[model samples]
Target chain A: MLELSRRRFLIGVGLSGLAVASPRLMAAGSSAGEQTFHSRPIPSTGESVPAIGMGTWITFNVGGDQYLIDERTRVLETFLERNGTVIDCSPMYGSAADVIGAGLDKLGAHDRIFAATKIWTSDGSETREQAATSERRWGIDRFDLLQVHNLLAWQEHLVTLKEMKAEGRVRYLGITTSHGRRHRELARIMETEPLDFVQLTYNVLDREAEERLLPLARERGIAVIVNRPFQGGSLFRRFQSEPLPSWAPEAGVGNWAEFFLKFIISHPAVTCAIPATTRVEHMQENMGAMYGQLPDTSQRRMMADYVRQL
Target chain B: MSGATWLSYSLQDFVMFGPEVFLRLFARINQDLWPWLLLWPLAGLVLPWFGRQAAELPRRLAMALAGLAWIGCGYLFLVRYYGPVNWPATRFGWAFVVQGLFLLILKGRALPGPMAWPVAVSWWLAVLLLPWLSVLEMPDLWAIALFGLAPGVTVAATVLLFAGQPSPLRWLLLMLPLVWSLFSAATYWALGTFWLMGFPVATLVLLVVALRFNPSPAQNPGSQSVHRGPGRQSP
Candidate 1:
């Protein structure tokens, strides 16, 4: 099993998110042993990160509840153990950033994770202040990625984010919009601005991004982080009751989680897919997508058609 | 953003936490305020009795106690507890403290018109029945959202207790509760906790009815029987 420490892993990977089939990863299957997950590189920097990352939106916003905090800590542990990195959060998510900080503190796994949060204040002047506060909240020296949340004051924040990136304060800087919002503005930003990553909503069902943004990211050599990969858990509500298609195994999808996640990460342009979950089992299932065979273009089409029919 | 763009989002999009996390707030707050939790129910029970008293001094003292409850609920529950999960809750908590001060310092006679027996029964319902709803949902005794402690129940019961106050001051006092009803309603609805959603919706209904069903001064018992001196007319 490949159980490399965070520093060793980063050094070994050398920021290449390109996939490599590991005999160790395949051999460690269905066991407590650490397994290798597929990683994709940041297009600009060639920094590799696990294609399947955890999202701390509602899942990690457990507030001051000690029990819930402890529970989320275990989930974070599960994600880290499975070789998952690139944990994404936002200041807009109430206590999510705080809870991530708490979970990191409890697990002492800060070094093992890629901490990405956003600057959400509408005041452009407060961009650095907000980032400073988020740094304290996450208990991190600096953020790996900082994005303008929902395009609020994007113009002003983008200037600050660029400066921070130049000063080595933030590893990557970008802008984000979710629930299929502000695509025109986001696309325009991608075209005009120099960004390291762009976060947007895309799932098997919500494929509006496929028409433009995904291709645009590929064309621009900008990495894409897909949010709402499960369509806020609605896809499961719609499809969980149904049986998997007979060809599901051909795509290496054992459950609905892999079925949903593999579709997103399989996209050549996608750097990662962030699906938030509160359960350890669910986190395990989500991390499972980072391994196994991703769907080819034909398989991808078949998977989409199968979901569409169902 | 266009209306079509804005309308595309759902209520759940705004609510960032689940019922599992939200309901535990009651248990957490209850545990934090153990033993002192006894005072909330005591304040709830005694408040209506003071409303019925002919003497303004007893009513003033009762309102002061109720004011203390608001301060406690707002600061301890809303600010320290719920605010961590919901940012708007901190602002609402400060508003609750202000409402508490209003109850403490505002003229007691401004809250003329003793609560009718029917309204008083509803007040009892808020005090006795509503808190248990949390207990039922979480199936934990520690999850009880006691009156004068939980914002939802406290706001509901307060709406009923102050139903008889005159306008302007009455509106001023009830404004936070009314706004709270909307916030709670949206929150609960988004969380898909319909059972918890009913409390805020009921508070909103009670507010509408209380403001609309104002009886004439001649028909009011508190106006005719309670002291209606020239100096005490304005809130």
Candidate 2:
């Protein structure tokens, strides 16, 4: 049976190659032994998303050059190897969604991906069109999660999204906002909308979300996706010439990036924190944030105090 | 006279180039003329309004020439200050390059928009203070008191200068240069340059000049206009 499964895998690889002619498939199959997978439960659905999701906002904005495509394919492979299924993209992040789609195709991870994207336009028609475009771009009949980006045109999109959810075209309907600018609005929507998930910026430095949005999400039974876990590179800057705080080890954070991210994910409300990275090493570091001992409430306060001191 | 004398002579030859040698070194260092390149428009727009007409021509000409010469000088200084393949410098250089490219593509200009001034200033401060603040246990006491104070001073000066009709945005904008200068000072320290001591003097001069030559014109009826004190329009 083991031999049979191995042969099936080989056949899957052969078919995948014949179907897509992707070198990524060849590499992925060849390096299966080297890959590691990690998983976390989706708060709403109980389905696991590989803890290390790919962020295509800034890194995947490299358009469609072959180099970028190859790098993206590797990134996808890395994520998949680590049991990561979430690929967060947005229509608002330049050409990232399109690039991610192409990378997904090249990596043959389209079906494997827990595909996530946003509808940013205001008009209902335009929102619908954008959703359709995302579907076409990703070459998928159904999306794992379709979010309203920054609450823009969300009211109009939510109705259609609900309809789509009922139609089984979208597995989840959600909303997201970055920058912590609209937490009050997000909380209101979480209360009003039947949201499965909600994404927003939350990190140690910016604890404003914790004041209300986090608890609200927990109460609403919405899975919380943390964005800008590194505070858009500000946290890293704070650690530039400084040694990692000694207490970081107590919380099981090895590096400053992981330290910041782990603090965010440690919150009970946080399902996942999608920290973007351009380097595979950084991807690995970010993924590590998902594992290990998380800071408790006391430790989180300690971390906050430490950051303030810096 | 002695073996030590011969070694010292060789070392001096390598390190301290004679006056003629220093001139050539400066020429090589100044090849790209980046400092001068950046200084030209600053002088052209700023100096004349300062009532320093005699200084203007010489300063402008010197800046233009320096801009031309510093390309090489700047390269040499960079090579000396940061060893070959310095990651941080390389990163900053690439950032500038990409920014220049982006500006070119978007606005058909190499320089950023005026709104970018605040951002630039903020970046400069961050660059200077971040490194120090990172390692220091008491950043407020040491780093903030020393370097961080500049932004406060600049902000206060802007508020005072703008007085009753001040736009908060303009006051915020002044903080940029202060922050940036702090960052540069920090960078110099990180690079182990004794010459960084001269930075405060340069910063003071720039601050005074910047305050002296206000961007707002007198005839402009904008509320944010910088009018000369008592009744006359501010230069």
B174 in model 2: Cα distance from truth in Å? 29
Residue A153's C-alpha lDDT in candidate 2?
74
Distance (Å) between predicted and true CA of B17, model 2? 44
Indicate the residue-level lDDT of B45 in model 1: 90
Candidate 2 lDDT over B130-184, as tens digits, reads 3233123222222221121122222222222222212453444334335545644
Q: What is the DockQ of candidate 2?
A: 0.02
Off by over 4 Å in 2: A1-39, B1-235
lDDT by residue (tens digit), candidate 1, B93-180: 9999988987887646555654555666677777888887777777888998888789888888778656667555677777788888
Predicted complexes: DockQ each: 0.81, 0.02
Q: What would the per-residue lDDT of candidate 2 be over residues A9-79, giving only the tens digit for each residue?
A: 44345435433753332231122221212244566676555444666665665432345556766766776
lDDT of each: 0.81, 0.54
Highest-scoring model, TM-score? 1
Mind giving the per-residue lDDT tens digits that candidate 1 earns over A25-57? 533122223343467878887767778898989
Instruction: Give interface RMSD, per candidate.
Output: 1.0, 20.9
Chain A (candidate 2) TM-score to true chain A: 0.84
Error of 2 at B82 (Å): 32
Q: Evaluated on chain B only, what are the TM-scores of all the candidate structures, in order?
A: 0.87, 0.32
Backbone clash pairs for candidate 1 read: A15-A46, A15-A47, A15-A48, A17-A39, A17-A40, A17-A41
